[model samples]
Target: MRSSMTIVHAPQSDIKMIPSPILTQVESFQHWKNDIIRDIARYRAWLRDNVIYDQRVDKELQLIQARLRDKTLSIAFVGEFSRGKSELINALLFPQSEQRLLPSTLGRTTMCPTELIYEQCSEPYLKLLPIETRQEALPLKHLKQQEDRWLHIPLDINDSKELQNTLSHIGDTKKITVEEAELLGFDCQFLESSSDAHVYVPTWRHALINIDHPLLRQGIRILDTPGLNALGCEPDLTFNLLPDCQAIVFLLNVDSGVTATDMQIWRDHIGQLQDRSATNLFAILNKIDLLWDDFADDEEIKQSVKKMKTLTAQQLNLEESAIFTLSAKQGLHARIKGDEDLLKKSNIAQFETLMFESLIDKKEQSLRKNAIEKTIFLLGNTKATLQAQLKQLEADNRSVIAMLNQGHGEMKSIAQQAKRDQVVYQNQIIALKASKQAIAKQVNTLLLSVNQDHFSTYLETTRTNFKESWSSIGIRESIAHFFTCLESDFTHLEIETNTTIKIVWSIYDKVLANSKLTHNANDDNHPDNTDSNIDKNIDRNIDRNIDRNIGNTIDSNIDNDINNNWDSHSSEQEHDLDLVQPTEFRIFEFNHSLAGLKTKATQYQKSFRSLLSGQRKSTHHFFNSVAAEAQQIHQAAHVEAKAWADGLLIPLIQHATSRKLLLDQKVKVFKALAETNKSQRQKQQELVQFQASIQLQFEDINLMIQSVSQKRPQQSFYESLKLKSTPISSEPQVY
Candidate 1:
């Protein structure tokens, strides 16, 4: 039994007040306002028809609930060549493990993103997949075979030895051979020559290898990227890949400091990703051991540090305090030895602390809080809206019940008509169900017909085109001609050297004029009081001493009076010499210096000349190597293309065709059902009319009840019902 009553009360002064809950949470409502409006419209429609509306509501709620679940936080390590990204990961993970899988040398080591995860299961498995099967998994041993697309390596133990064994198979240090390139499905036409020799390719083209490690399984994904510069001007490796990193560590060699190339890399790659307020960037001064040795004095060491700090700051646009200096090798040693003192001294301890406590932890907390706050706000608004709608629906239902009570006399007559309308609606629902099933079947069939093999064929064709295009350009010959021209320009060093010396002599004459001086004596000829013969001897000695001291200083002590005059005169001469000597002597000194320079320059020219000749001989050999590699790649691409066409594309095509046929079948079924349900349309029309009529009656009944309630003052409905000896029968029942 249910009761429906309508009452009109006097408007309260606070009726205009907005709910505090809604006002307080205005920011939260912004994200869900559109969804909330849509939901309200849907509920109104559902009030007219319950079956369809309830189903949709349930589905929507499920999706919303799923979205509230915890999401994994992914942190990636990314940087240019040999920037120690992989070593950083190793330091974090296997503090004691000595085995290095990622290449630490000058060349590139990682070809693709390799993931390390820990598995609690007993047998450690390595999985490889074919390049064609990007989404599928395969086994490790398959990597050894030329025809095999991918490798899956499973390590049996948790130690460094086991990890090394697994890594060794993939980390082949030898230069890439023509056979290897061909085996890897590269086109041979792009190669310079058709020889069977080895060629070098950049290491970023292969698939990622996953190693089962305990630390990685704990939810850390380390990404090692190729050098900042790409090979052969390839766009994919350079401009396309590096922008997505969340945190960056820029490694600089302490010995070289930051070179022009490093700045170029920064401008081209790192600077582009910077947002000073938001991004966390670390400049690591690596290999700091080069700055000092055990025998280096304290002052020298301090000066070196100061110079390194100043230079790094200027080049990187960072404060001296921001840059961290560390030795990666020494850090690893400290971690293994469990020596905290050594680790602190090694400089990596500060970096480790920043990563673990400051950066990673802060990021995680901020992301989690943001997600939670957003979810709570959305959920709260949704709940409030639902409550308001429920209240309104209750009021509407009460009015309907009252109407039904008032129209009891007409209801029996309408029941027969309503039954017929119900049958019509049921028929329409059945027809719609049939149509939906047909559409689903068609979609499934269509999906099956879409073959993946066609994509592989397309890839192979593109690769072949690229190879032919490279070959047609004849880049090797162009490079050779450029080298030849450069060699010829530097061949006339001896002639240039002679011309430079002649210019030096002309400048020296002007310098010699100011250096000549005349000294005064007591007597015009003889100053000392002595015989002419004795005086002549003394004068000779003095003249000899003066000659020795000219344009130079004499170390021997003389009479104080004589020394004072000489010093004063020499002081005056020193000022004049200082003005002219540097400018004049430098020219002559440079001429002398140029002799050695010219010899070295001539030797360099000869060496380069020999190298040019050797390069000409090697040009053919290099081209042959390139050509062979390209040909091998072309052959492999051909085979792979065929396999892809057969294995993936053909099936997709068939599946698509089948799906289309199924869709056609579904369309036919829906058409037939619609025709069969034509009679049900009339019944549905009658049901709508009867519902409207009943609604009007309920409205009238509610008005009458309200009038009666207003007239009976000083007693509420519930109180009135309680006072009555017999029940007033205010509650109503309806189905």
Candidate 2:
């Protein structure tokens, strides 16, 4: 029938360079983030040394630093079983190893979704949650925090074979009754034996692989998912994990092509990602070595592979350029033997380079927006403060020189003017503090609009309604009404929050205008007299002004696309799609979290097999999970709202305090010159030295700001690969 392929083995060599382009980019991004953190630390120290430290700003920097340290780049591999998903991960992560790093073999190797990550606090181990925990009324996220609930197995990193053997337990299964399977959310149709009374189910619901791999240590997380059945059974996979992943690698077998099950998986899970700009999608036609025919020449094999890739791209509705063909098994073997020619033939390197290049581009842009842009904006404010101080100093210096020329008469007038400005500054400080209190009260009122107690009441009312009528329609309608109320609550909260933000902004702006008027009135030499026209009508109707300026107000926009409803029953593909747009809002995050819960509820409602009397346990479990998730969301939203309210006046207060300090210094300087016996020449020399000192400080801060904003140049590995476009023949080619 077919000629055997020969294996040419060479001495295995260690991977000298970073194994993957994604790893390279992650390393660069991590280093750049560290550098920025170091710069921020230095800037904070400098501020403290200069006696200009703002506690509020320092807290914000601390929060940013924490986020940078905790940030992770996650990639998910999705496909049916036997698609070489696990094999591809092994080839990518442990190329030099003689055996597979993960359990990648024939049949369903990964029965549960496995996440490979690194946590420095924990030793190398495998943490697995029992499948029975599915009956728990808490979300997986909540369950993860309960360490005792997971079965921990320590991993021996020194032995790759031992590690692989241990991970193979992810596919461990147990025979359970069909009733139990259905109760645990398993589709019995996928069971090994439909005629049997019992079915095989995954022993573990989820897997966490924590290791000290270089890539994982640098915050690169790999999510190895199960087949289509698992995707449908686990709501977290569809609603939470899939949506959160930045890149999804959808694998398909070249020989099998795209089957109905594959299309279903794509439409329900991976297809929607095509609309997400933040997420990079790649359809991989794996196991290409299966198509390597002994009867065919090299050109014919290439043509076959190219045709498969093109068809896969069309099937997935992705560009051909985004579809890659490779043989993970061959790639792993090639790497282990250090056979360069075999590795090239495997096409793994080419696929990795292109896929990671696209992923890295998106990742870098996100980092730039969240870290670089926000840091620059904050530093810009500090720079503005320094410049303002310099200007005030120069103005004070000029007044001193004026006193030296004009004599005692002008000095007395200047002293009187400084005292009047001091009184005005004190009044403005009290007014700003009052405004801060007012906003705090308003934010407290706004938080009450989303209170946990209120949500619990609504949930209880729905449960009561459902219990009154024991039909499926009653429960479904009750759930729908609950969600409708929930959505209405957030809609009302959004409106109230916007109003509060505008009111808070108006009060701060008015106080700032008053403070500026005082400073400008005193500093005759000050440049930019823009504050003179800053709506001197603060006593006018504030509500009318807020309404007029609502459009200009910073609306807390959200990522509406992150939580699109997954309609599994609807076969029609949704052509109208929205990308994940950039926006900042804690409420939106909370809102999206609710969207996932709503999706879970919808799935649960559809899964109802009987009336409430017949399926009381299932119905109760569903409602309990929803209620728990709702309570958690409420608590989290409360915390965010409280923090927001606390920080609302921080920037304004910091600015006002800095300006007040400068004003006080000016008043003291004027008094000292007016009442002192110091000679004119000495005063002039002191002024000159002060001006030089301010200039030096300004230059140092400017350099620090630049260092924080400087971009790190990362070389693109995809370009280095020089991959050619797929060659299509004039005539049709088929395998």
Candidate 3:
């Protein structure tokens, strides 16, 4: 059995033993374990500081922890208007129910955030609380006002009945009325009193709901977002709440793969938060059932799907495979029929699998294993290399100790020579200091003779020159040029407005003519003996009214017309007009000031010159005093330089010399260690090769032993005797 095992032998020349396989394996295991422990500690600290200790992040962490404990995962359904987001949710969760949370009509829905959670209880209660300034709750009625507040309402019903009733009030497709706005507590005056009166008030119902559903009970929460208009209208709800979702399933109609409105929503809201690693975003090309008509073949549908996927990927900066095509309507039908095979045939099943794998399963596995593997690989190699180097360093240190002792005496002699050189430089520094002091004293005396007040007087003369320059240029003409430019712009605007009014009035006349003929004639017959003059007068009045209305319409559009004209005219006029020319005036002022200052400067120079001529003897006396002070300064500097040379420079030079000696010794030691390391590494390599050979030989012998053991029953007595005799003759191999 032992002979069957592979054995590796060391080379005859290689006395060093490389570690055994068991030891190598243990070392690898230890390295891996140590690195794991370190990484865990590091991650623990980071998690504590960033995720746990920080108040804002702590809440998120706590929520994550709670969700994990509850085995719940949240999927946010988000996109622009009419993207089939709510339809997708219904298809996934409650296909059988006739009621829906979405507003299918041509009006905005989902006014505020709504959360769907699981409740085991049968009787659902509706709880309403108004939004408040702080955490304190307010009355639900308060939300009716035009305040920056929200409301929370819990409805009462076991099924979807209560939800249907509550949402019905806000789900009407008709134009919003003043009465509805008053009931919703919205300020209607802004919409009702405008000259172009238009009512588009948002729905009143806004709350989080807890429903008893199989999906919710299975630990899945869904957020069916409102249309683009509603979300854009209330940006705060979208930005603050949508980003926190674990995953977003963006639904897009397959018929209209991507639209301008979708791009607008993406740019304004989703784009900013798309880069986060924690947020898992997916795109759904929904309503594929619409494409399954007779006109389009399977291949055409496939190509269309591919094109949409590519376009979406390019727009969103994501992988093409991430965007999926599915039919929510088909999925709903498949689910209700209990046809697993049919469900698998649909794209919705593929999307479901993708969501489960990418968002839930794969994400959890990546978070666990990725860092662990990276840390193990990195630290394992590092520890092995460091251990090898450390071993060589220990042997080299012994040689370095001996070399340092040998170089000690020579280092001291070299240091002494450096100190002697430092002394010579110190004497030179003293002479330079004396020369510098003498020059400084002469410069100070030269400065003291000049008067600064004369310079200010000269600057005043420059101001007078600037005033004369302005008079020569004629300021009135410059002002007239500016007014001329202004009048031209105003005239251009008026002309453009008049042209636009003429065109608009022509269109208005045609519209009025058509409208007058279309008016019902039945009211005329019902009138009891109406005066003919009165009817004629009314017709004239109507004509006059139409003219006035058309006039007002032209007036309303005048600003836009003028602005467009200004944009075109300004571009052309910008090159022609350089009216102000302020730069020219500034330059004239600067040059004049400098010219005036020159006269005062010259007078001051003359006064200094005359003083020097009369007081030469006194100047000589001052020079002598200055020279004496310079001599004293020179002496003090000489002493300071000498002290620096002796105390600082000499020691520094000595230290540098000693460092060089130490370095030379270290180099010699390193050379010896290199030779030793080279020899050891060679020995280890040879041992490893020999061990591999032995292992191969051992494996061969094991095969022979197994064959012999198996053939023992079939062998004759003579054959057995021969086999036993063969081992006796090869007794030296046992060694």
**What are the Cα lDDT values of the candidates?**
0.37, 0.67, 0.40
lDDT of candidate 3 at residue 455, scale 0 to 100: 28
Candidates 1 and 2: which is better by lDDT? 2
Model 1: per-residue lDDT, tens digit, 104-205? Answer: 444455434444444445355544333222111222222334434545566654455555545533323234676554443323333333345665443423
**Rank ordering of all candidates by lDDT, starting from the highest:** 2, 3, 1
Model 2, position 351: C-alpha lDDT score: 71
Instruction: List residue ranges in candidate 2 displaced over 4 A.
Output: 1-22, 95-99, 159-164, 194-197, 229-232, 271-278, 293-307, 317-321, 353-373, 395-424, 461-472, 512-637, 664-682, 717-735
State the weakest 10-residue window (summed lDDT) of model 2.
574-583
lDDT score for residue 619 of model 1: 27
lDDT of 1 at 488: 28
lDDT of 3 by residue, 466-565 (tens): 3343332332233233223323333443343344333322322322232333232213432432234334433544454455434543355645644554
**Clash pairs, model 3 backbone:** 4-702, 7-694, 7-695, 8-691, 126-154, 126-155, 127-154, 144-185
Clashes of 3: 8
lDDT of 2: 0.67
1 versus 3: better lDDT goes to = 3
TM-score rank order: 2, 1, 3
Cα RMSD (angstroms) for every candidate in the order listed: 43.1, 10.4, 42.2
